[model samples]
Target: MARVVWHVPVTTSGPGSTTALRLFRLRDGRRCAVGFSSPAALAALLGPDQAHTELGEPALHALTTPLGVDVLVLDPRLVAPPVTAPATPAAPAPTALLQHR
Candidate 1:
């Protein structure tokens, strides 16, 4: 069976105050770590007195709809497009008369 990986963002308040939580889950009950960010601005995006919690599969499925978290699907063979080099003007061909001078 093909595995599907999902990137979920979670928010919690603690020592660092603000953080980007990354949750990865596969189709066959397998999971792995992806990545996260520690941007303070993320706090503003959250509402006041909002409760945050991380629950396992059981609790996660209990919810009828998505909560505060944003889910993103990730491709296993992720690769960034190659950056092309800037074009440089070719040097003008040297003229025979100019070369002789």
Candidate 2:
């Protein structure tokens, strides 16, 4: 029998460029780890630019358990579009001041 593996999202952390498992929060604010059954499933929910790695279900659980994360969401559907921050306004140029002798 073929074993099932999942695509887990990851983010770079610290100066050493270590990869960390990306966790999500539920509507109630509880933290949960997320994984996708396929690369397409992951991209559909998190977009094509998201970074990920492949792991089995047991491996995913082992990595998340220590972080107090017990829930593993697989192939989750989005109820709404993802939110993004508004762009920051450009800074104004400094003006030269004339000094009086």
Candidate 3:
């Protein structure tokens, strides 16, 4: 079965945050870009909290901000996928670890 499309809602407030909570979803393993692009339009999206940021990038999502990194990153809340979940009762970590060592 095809993997389910994961939808993420990103809300930012405080310095460099959006004035209102905005939602963005992942598409084809990449973030689907938002369309609100004018400098004034972008500014309106940010309340006093994010007023200090300079408006750049016309095609930016309303809820995203650079976190000292030039590239986008996966949200920290995303845990290792189900495939990486704890081993089943049939298989345990200690047995595997001892076998390899």
Candidate 4:
């Protein structure tokens, strides 16, 4: 039987570029970024494979909906972060004025 995989977040320290969020999976305590996708809101649980970082057309519609039969397991850690009030924009810099004697 295939080992159960747990979903994880792609925090700052996690691998993968900002263009696509890093999809992590914890199998038997070992964490690895299995894939990356921008459109896919949720990460899919695949049998431990390296993530595809290439910036190209996504052949697969969604991570969970692969080409054929797939196993997807959910974890509690995949919760949306708490919403916080937006920060106020900084004030513009002062303009320089020249004085002639």
**Cα RMSD for predicted model 1:** 13.7
lDDT of each: 0.40, 0.89, 0.36, 0.38
* Tens-digit lDDT track of model 4 for 1-101: 54333332333435543534344345445333333333132334222342333322222225434433133333323444689876987678998999999
Model 1 lDDT per residue over 1-101, tens place: 54332222465667778654445554554453332122222233333333334334334433412543333332233344679876997788987664553
User: In terms of lDDT, which candidate is strongest?
Assistant: 2
lDDT at 18, model 2:
93
- TM-score against truth, every candidate: 0.24, 0.72, 0.20, 0.22
Candidate that scores best on TM-score: 2
- Which residue pairs collide, candidate 2? none
lDDT by residue (tens digit), candidate 2, 1-101? 79999999998875579998888888888999888999999998899988999999899999989989999988887766679775887678998999999
Residue 74 lDDT in candidate 3: 25
For model 3, residues 4-100, the per-residue Cα lDDT tens digits are 2212223456556465324334434443333233334444544323323322333233335442212332222323455655565565445443555
User: Which stretches of candidate 2 lie above 4 Å from their native place?
Assistant: 13-16, 81-101
The runs of at least 3 residues in candidate 3 whose Cα sits more than 4 Å from the true structure, single-residue gaps closed, are 1-18, 33-90, 95-101
Pairs of residues clashing in candidate 4: none
Find the number of clashing residue pairs for candidate 1: 0
